[model samples]
Target: MSASERYTFREVTPADLPLLAEWQLRPHVRKWWDTAEPFTAQKLKDTRVKRWIVETTQRPFAYLQDYSVHGWEDHHFFSLPKGSRGIDQYIGEADMTGKGHGPAFIAQHLKALFEAGVPVVATDPHPDNTRAISAYKKAGFEVFGSSQATQWGLILPMKVSSSS
Candidate 1:
């Protein structure tokens, strides 16, 4: 079945911490989502970001988050219009990778954000993460400009404006 038909999202909760931590340790995930410490429910609550668990018909297999660019620490992205939301996500299950799920799920999330009055959605992936960059492009995001070095690493900023 197609990813659009198999994927859905649910709010992340304390009960999901173990699964989240496990995913965080996965080699594919760790390569891009580096952190000195393990993920915890308390850490998630303390942040302003909104997070979701991406589920397939069979089981949960990914994590996703959306936060306001302006609300985050001052960055080049703040130069964009206000209410622009930024996204970060990954398919945690190794089996789920390379199956077009990333773009499908991202496009679904973007539609919901736009419908909810967000004017734009953005994502910044490490320039070397070709898989992610390709998925973002397929999901309708366009590279807004050149790559920029950030504390997180070098990122290629991309965005999708609401049709409204």
Candidate 2:
């Protein structure tokens, strides 16, 4: 945790998958995901994958989960540029969106990631996700281009500030 009173990051343990899967299967989450993508509880037990699970411990009222999905050939919303580290996350609970938690979560996580030695963090949302676009801008990510069509990608580059 940084001394600036942001969020704390914790690794997801095997015991946490039940809740994770439950959240993933929620109607709103499923709709947002738009795929019958099954996130079985057993999937969280794997340690060899490049993905990671982390939780936000800031603003006690608004909990969030960050998932760094590996794009080993799969191009999703967060497919990174050659040297970029990608970040994908969501509030994970229905009651948490539209409550101004997104910016806080992004800011805090970027701070932590920079401290941990990541020079840049990249995010690519579908061009139509207005709320996400607003939140990403609010968190200091700058749109670089709109040329991605293969997976509906909209790339943004976020440079980490030294003060963070």
Report the C-alpha displacement of residue 60, candidate 2, in angstroms: 8.4
| Tens-digit lDDT string for candidate 2 (1-164) | 45444555555556655665676777756554433554445654554232334344533322233334353456443454343356556556677779777777777777766777655666666666677778878888777665466543344433333343
Q: Taking the tens digit of each residue's C-alpha lDDT, what string does model 1 give over 72-137?
A: 566657877878899999889999999988998888888888889889888999999999999999
Each model's TM-score?
A: 0.91, 0.67
Clashes of each: 0, 0
Using lDDT as the measure, which candidate wins? 1
Q: How accurate is candidate 1 locally (lDDT)?
A: 0.86
Model 1 stretches astray by more than 4 angstroms: 1-6
Most TM-score-accurate candidate: 1
